[model samples]
Target chain A: MLYVELIAQGLIQGSIYALIALGLTLVYGLLRILHVAHAAFFTLGGYVGVVVANQTGSLAAAIVAAMIVAGLGGIVVFRLCYQPILHQPPFVPLIASIGLYIAAEELFRIVFGPSGLTYKYAFLQGEVELLGFLRFKTGELVVVFGSAAIIGVLSLLQTRTRIGVACQATVSDPQMAESFGISLSRVGDINFFVGSALAAFAGVMVSVLNNMVEPTMGSVPSYKALAIIVLGGLGSVRGTLVAALVLGVVESFGTIYLGHFLDRNAIAFAFLILVLMWRPQGLFARS
Target chain B: MLRLERFSCGYGLFRAVSELELEVPHGTITGLIGPNGAGKSSTLMCVAGHVNLLAGSIVFDELDIGGLPATERVRRGIAIAPEGRRLFKDLSVEDNLRVGGLIHPAGRFKADRDYVLSLFPRLGERLGSLAANLSGGEQQMLSIGRALMARPKLIMIDELSLGLMPKMVDLCYDALLRLKQDGMTILLVEQNTDRVLSVADHVCVLESGHAVWSGNAADARNDPTLAAAYLGLH
Candidate 1:
């Protein structure tokens, strides 16, 4: 049925949103920044993935290259921009991130042309039959599997590694973490790089699903992801996923039942206001 | 041996400890006793490389450790149980010890963890509980135990008796005595002058950021002039 297909599409979109939100939540949780340029990283990743795939003629190589570049971009941004403004007022970085976002968008437009480009990754096209009533596009399946894999690896890293332990400690108390000899700056760099890399991967997924990429394609997804992150909770990873899926399903059903005339932006804003009014801290804020 | 030569350390332009010349020979317990704002914690911070020195040199076993970071200092066998018992509150008591052992120059987690648990048997019973869930006395014990996991040659503790019941303080001091018996050199900073001096081999009194009196604990206890001059008490 069309309803099932719409649900499938929404779920795939939600997975990508969840990925972006995960990264955004992480950097915000650690550094307490809004990181308005996060969407810029997403768009950057899409363009990079396309260029890399065309150059290498391999999807895996393209995704990996996209991730590396985005990760490094995150590190560079932290080192060159965030580091200098660490002691300044909160608004300094917020305004600075806006500048960064604009700069990244302009750079992308200049490099890739203002017009959107079509993706030619043959492997990502076509559909597969699932159960009797369910079906999924190859890209949708990739979104499901790829996002899960990335989340799994990150969870393992967070719970097991020394760097991860140090990060958690730094989040708890930067001064105390420093006393233990953990470098807060290095942790910031790593968190930024890794988080942006995940967003970059989501960008790649979006490009594959839509069969096209644009300079400002990340704009809508980033906004939705940010909304999802807030709805879930500021720093709660599990909450991000749950909130993303719920939003995805709700939007899917809303579009079908209430007619396409119901603007998604309005719906999202209404939901955000309602939730914040009821629970200002989000659903599962870590206390 | 750890030696400080006219060491002055503080935050920014404000000096908390100045002209502090002291030494803790290997395998000895040294107490730094003073009233509030007398720079006992600053002196320990200087030795532990947590505070930047404004002037003078801190030499640990003949190495100028002024340029070293805190972890490097710990790697070189200088560990600190800082003021306020700053534990990783969200982490389990066992995980706290795990991270403490992570900075160890080399070791197996299970083995070193077991060793730390053995040293603080109370921690063994609460290994699964988060650090914040532990009582103040238990958290203090966990902090000290974490430092011990590093197997440092010199351990500097600040206000080990802070915010604890009198009985808990006795238990904490008993552990300090045991650490001494096991041949760990220590620098203890506290306002509990009588309590620290009673067990200390040597005692240094800091007043207005300068060493006002330095002598054997017996001498500090016996000399009325030095005692009154340092703390305005006998």
Candidate 2:
């Protein structure tokens, strides 16, 4: 029962990391930028969903509103912030993103509150039997299947659609993409929109899972997603997903076994350090 | 038709090409020949809106295009088979060609792809193969075929024969001639002065970003100084 609970928690949290990291992977893959403010989108999405769900009492409405709001926020951030510093220096855009992250956190504090907010979701509350001995929350199961569905849809978009092919082509060669009449600016904007929406979706899902939304909640997961992308290979979607799951499970098991001295974050970082020391090029990256 | 006057373009704080004037009229092949570091590639890139243009204007069909972005330039029927063959190495040959014709309707993919395959039949065999896996000659063929997919009014070929086998060069030149007969305007840059001069309607020789001579191909062939010094003619 303990093992089942631990594994289930790990998988649910890992799926959130995977979802958020997909956005990071897309931005990094195409624009070659880290986009730290992606966390802000996630955080904002949670807040938006919470407010809307509280008011409208409809999870569907809140989810739709949060995604749309976060998606637009992404486009705006790209145009106003990221685009200006695109060709400056390597760290220029990165620093800009970090600055945006800080500003967004402050903005959230001002708009919402500095404290955390919790939800009383009447739907899918409490735990149900998972095999014979193990019990799991209905919400956790929804998370597992829901995130999987999102990842599947995203993968299909990237692999099967023409626009997705264009995105891949742009990622490979920006100059060639432009020559072929595929606007790089347009691609950047579209990617920013998609990536931000994914981040927001993960934010809302994680908030619902925990039944708590905090302004600082976006940071740990966002940073963990970043670490996962680096560990999985920066631009490889498959790699990011695998690395996210591994980190989630490692953090989970470490928290369970390591006792009160070491936290999940510390365990995650220690694992990251070991992974970096072992495979600097990333575990699944191709040469 | 394409025209440039007093055009200077380069990387930041350093000009690669300067004060160039040339006009390529309809249905003609203009050979642009120069030695290494003569800004041949830079000039083409600037015209394609990739490099920084410091001064002057680019006129295509008498409309000023110097202010346009690369994709807008491509939309206005200008295409380039860039010097490095810059094919998306991860994508298959068919995918590369499909991207080339992206400005057009989706329904046109098959027809445009078929047209390119007809020009470079080798690409048809390697349609499913990644561009990185192709030989140098096949890559060059794919590059040119990819450009042809754009259905451009003017096609620019930079170093069309460079690093290509004689047979492959012959095939590419044959396709260029076919395109010319189909009423396409061509601007060809080449290290092979003999081949360029043989097929070119007019020739412009650039040395160190300056035009040393410009005339009909026959006239350039007849001039003693240009023939001996630039064209390697005795």
Candidate whose DockQ is highest: 2
Task: Name the DockQ score for candidate 2.
Answer: 0.77
Q: Which 10 residues in a row give candidate 1 chain B its minimum summed lDDT?
A: B98-107
- Tell me the lDDT of model 2 at B131: 94
Q: Each model's TM-score, in the order given? A: 0.91, 0.95
lDDT per residue for candidate 1 within A93-141, as digits (tens), equals 8889889988888888898899987666575778788877777778789
User: Number of the top candidate by TM-score?
Assistant: 2
Q: What is candidate 1's lDDT per residue for B1-234, written digit by digit as tens? A: 899998999999999998899999888889998889989898887777777799989999898998887767878888888898889998889777766766654357778777666667788999999999999989998988888877789988999888888888888888888888889999999888878877899989988898888979889888988767675565
Worst 10 residues of 2 chain B by lDDT: B225-234
Compared with the true structure, all predictions reach lDDT values of: 0.83, 0.87
Error of 1 at B53 (Å): 2.3
Cα deviation of B127, candidate 2, in Å? 1.8
